[model samples]
Target: MQHLDDSTRTELEAAAFRRLLHHLDEHKEVQNIELMILADFCRNCLSKWLVAAAEERGETLDYETAREYVYGMPYSEWKSLYQAEATPEQQAAFEARQAAKQEKGQ
Candidate 1:
């Protein structure tokens, strides 16, 4: 909020991010593709954003490490543990959604 000091706002934002990660972890059955289809972003997207932010700050943060941070374990482990193959219908819907976004220049 505009009334909050910078440090307080940053702390609150960081806390919210942590809570979001915790919530995602709690809902492990929710796949990344489903998130991308519904919300346009997923844990992997968060990881990439984290790396981009580090780069902007003149730091080097690799994708795998960033992904591990978001995933709470190595991404391969997370995939094996919780990720599922999208059904044919889900894949078709995802493709349509992506095409619509592209057409809209989103």
Candidate 2:
């Protein structure tokens, strides 16, 4: 990667991101709370990152549009179809993970 040209690196990164979105789309049962507990990020976080990235490039990306891209549909539609209420265990795990991050001054 150190030897790769900037354009090539960017292309590879973009491809990887697309693959990640596809993968997440395929795994809709893996809810956002599980992602937050395990990885500290989720689909909404990806949408926010995209919005921030577009802003950095002097572009305006609406959050809902980014979310639609990431979710493969309008978020409201996706939520109605697939999103689940967080189980008590999942909520506890997510809170513990946040506490750990706080302890590390993240």
Candidate 3:
């Protein structure tokens, strides 16, 4: 990686990102709250990041469009098909995770 050219490095990173999206799409049962509790990011975070990246590059990307790209469909469709209500235990765990992050000044 250290020896890779800039374009090659960027290509590899983009490929990895696509792979991540595919993996997440394949695992639709994984709830966003679970992701936030464990990794501090979810599909929505990815969509926001995508929009920010496009803006940084002087490109236009709205949140809904980014979400469609990430979710393989409109977010509303995906939510209605696969999203589930978080259990009380999940909510508690997410709250604890947030508290821990705040305590660590993250």
Candidate 4:
């Protein structure tokens, strides 16, 4: 990373991020809750980060556009295609992880 110029490194990083979003979008059957449980990040988080990065550079990236970028289409379409309600056990496990994360931060 230190050896590469900032622009090159940034381009590589953005490309990698795009690839990840593409993979996730292609596998829409994988729910955000599952991503959060497994990787501690979700599509929403990725979208938010994209928007934040754009804003940091004085670019005007709105939420919907960012979400579409992350989803590889409109979010509603993605949700309709693959989103599902989590089971109680899944919800409980997520809550437990959240609690543990918060505890660690303290």
The best candidate by lDDT is 3
Scored against the true structure, residue 37 in model 3 reaches a CA lDDT of 90
Q: How many clashes would you count in candidate 3?
A: 0
Q: How many backbone clashes does candidate 1 have?
A: 0
lDDT for 3 (candidate 1)? 100
Q: Using lDDT, rank the candidates from best to worst.
A: 3, 2, 1, 4
Better of 3 and 4 by lDDT: 3
Those runs of model 4 whose alpha carbons end farther than 4 Å from true positions after fitting are none
Residues 5-98, candidate 1, lDDT per residue (tens digit)? 9999999999999999999999999999899889989999999999999999999999999999999999999999999999888899899999
For model 4, residues 1-106, the per-residue Cα lDDT tens digits are 9999999998999899889977986787888998888889899999999899989999999999999988888999888877899989879989988999999993
lDDT of 4: 0.89
lDDT tens readout by residue for model 3, 5-103: 999999999999999999999999999999999999999999999999999999999999999999999999999999999999999999999899999
Candidate 2 Cα errors over 4 Å, as ranges? none
Model 1 deviation from the true structure expressed as Cα RMSD, one decimal place:
0.7
lDDT of each: 0.95, 0.97, 0.97, 0.89
How do all models score by TM-score?
0.96, 0.98, 0.97, 0.91
> Mind sharing the TM-score for model 4?
0.91
Better of 1 and 2 by TM-score: 2
TM-score of 3: 0.97
How far off is residue 91 in model 3, in Å? 0.4
